[model samples]
Target: MEKYLPYAVLFLRIALALTILAFVADKMGYLTQAGTAPILWGDWDIYTKQLQAILPFIPGNISEKLAIVATLLEIILALMLLFGVKVRWAAIGTGIYALLVAIVAGYGVGINAILHYSLLVISAASFLLACCPIYKFTLHGIKKRSTYHPY
Candidate 1:
């Protein structure tokens, strides 16, 4: 178990990076649409209609901004996780983001969206596992205190 700790951390970091990188790539039009584009589902007209649908409570403009913010954050979080910087905080943030994605997809897009939500949850779990004390290949590994002690 101790001997393989570094490999485990490396796996987690790479997995999280790949997951988010796929999302970003898809958004940037590198990957073809997997399902119906959320904007075409209704009267919505925007680069990202899923954002508007998921955040009905916010004004359309604000919702668009929020969506952009969320996307940027995810990308940043992915990069941070890949580098193993602040792994504990990144894991917690990833978990919360995954939960939010699940809630939004559940409310706006129905059961089909759950698949994406589940992937996010898995990514979050990976990050959480990487933050464990036994995983010692990360940038945070040098810290004397275990930041992920709660988990």
Candidate 2:
């Protein structure tokens, strides 16, 4: 179990990054998969509509802009994690982003089977990942061992 830990952590990191990317893509109007089914919403609509639909507390005028900001933040954290620059801190940021997402998702959609649980669980998992100190490809490790000052 210990030997495979790095691989497992890497997979989780990739999964979270991909998840963030997909959300960002949907918002950017690139990955449209709405299909012909009227039940499904359009990819372009995900940016503003989903937020409005999920979180009524947010004002309609600023929802889209706030979403864009959130998306960019998520992308930054994801990239940091993917590049192994600062896994621990990036993971914490990711977790915070996920919580923000979950706050909207959970309350907007209500506590349902997959919808609410998925967001909450992913946010929680990110927090858990942050607690782990076994980052394989990260600058955090090097920083820990360095006793030299670059000033």
Report the number of the highest-TM-score candidate: 2
In Å, residue 96's CA in model 1 sits off its true spot by 1.1
The 10-residue segment with the lowest total lDDT in model 1:
38-47
Q: At residue 72, give the lDDT of candidate 2.
A: 78
Q: How much lDDT does candidate 1 score?
A: 0.66
Q: Rate the local accuracy (lDDT) of all candidates.
A: 0.66, 0.69
Q: Candidate 1, which segments miss by more than 4 Å at Cα?
A: 33-47, 123-127, 140-151
Tens digits of per-residue lDDT for model 2 on 1-151?
A: 8768777777888888787776666556566566533223346565478778776777987878886677779789888877776677788888887787667555667657236337677778789778775776456545676321212
Model 1 steric clash pairs: none
lDDT at 112, model 2: 70
Alpha-carbon RMSD, each predicted model = 4.9, 4.7
What TM-scores do the predictions have? 0.74, 0.75
- What tens digits encode model 1's per-residue C-alpha lDDT throughout 111-141? 6776743655665675576457654656555
For candidate 1, give the lDDT of residue 90. Answer: 74
Model 2: runs farther than 4 Å from truth? 35-41, 113-117, 139-151
